[model samples]
Target: MGLPGTIPPAQGPARPALAVVDVQPHLQQPATDRGPGRLHLSAEGASRAAGGSGGGEAVKVILLRDVPTLGRAGTLVEVKEGYARNYLLPRGLAREATAGAIRARDVMRQAEEQRRARVQREAEQLAQGLSALILEMRARAGAEGRLFGAVTAQQVADALRQRGFPVDKKQVELEHPIRVEGFHRVAVRLPTGRLVQVTVNVVGQR
Candidate 1:
């Protein structure tokens, strides 16, 4: 029965009960079901997010000259592609490691090795000559043995040069300043990593 101006509820077959199909744990849909294509896309996206596509293949270069914080001449090193192209390649400090370039670099490396060996031999000879040398210096001193002024590395190098030894001030290593007038041992580091000890005889000036 329907009242006036009121619609009667339309009647039809009741909705069928939802079938609770017991799905096994393995058969159940995973919470995150990424398909093979999606996984591939995700992996590529991850790689891009990490860096660039070319990040995997860094540029290999041979240094033509010494680069601070990088390497010395004739050194083969890997660097970023952008850095290689922008700075090293443009400045002639490095070249790409191609077949021809590698061959040329090997030749240069051999020549550099020979040059280094020659230099090392010269340094060893110099060190051996300097080992038996003694230097004498005259400085003003007070009643005690202490001098009025300290002897410097430059003074020692100058003395060595006056005696026909090609020595630089930087190569002379003094642990402390020479203030007293006496015999002191000075260490000179040669280019070949040999340490030569020389005796300096210091006397008071009259």
Candidate 2:
């Protein structure tokens, strides 16, 4: 006798498959590098960390300057093999992302950071000196309180320089020229948004 219902189709057990992925790390390069050859750094094993072991599809390069539509200097980037060999390498705009080159870049970056910090410290010291010192400016004036001419930022900066302070003309935050001869309060601007209030003693030239 035949079964009452149609025979059921065969069923099988389901199994899961595993997928894997690989990742790589890159390091910094120097912006001031104008030469094309790879740099060999003395930093211990830093070069090894910057090394890339991948093959074929693309080539890695460290940028020497800011490239339009690309990236800024000191960055490690990958580009098409032909593009790197034909353009970037030839123009000295970048160097091969060699282990040694990356190491050297890191060293240069550290030195640059140290130099900047030193400059910041010096600027702060100068700001302190400017705050305690008085800047005297002489101007020709008539009988009235108003002076014949106005005092400019250049004059203020020069006064500070004469007092042994390295100050730029732009550092003097004088909104307008001083028209009268008297005591004036001026703000001296410093790097990192620091401001120092300074006293200006303007005297009318006899």
Best by lDDT: 1
Q: Any runs in candidate 1 off by more than 4 Å, and if so which?
A: 1-99
Over 1-206, each residue of candidate 1 has an lDDT whose tens digit, in order, gives 88999999999999999999943212123246653211122333323422344433577888877665566777888766765675567768788888898999888779988999999989887887788887889999888888999889989989998998888999999877799999999998888777899899899874
lDDT of 2 by residue, 57-172 (tens): 57789999765444678788876665567556676768899999999989989998999999899978887788787788899988876789989888998988888887889888
Task: Write down the TM-score for model 2.
Answer: 0.59
lDDT score, candidate 1, position 119: 93
TM, every model: 0.53, 0.59
Among these predicted structures, which one has the highest TM-score?
2
Clashes of each: 0, 0
Q: Give candidates' CA RMSD values in order.
A: 14.9, 10.7
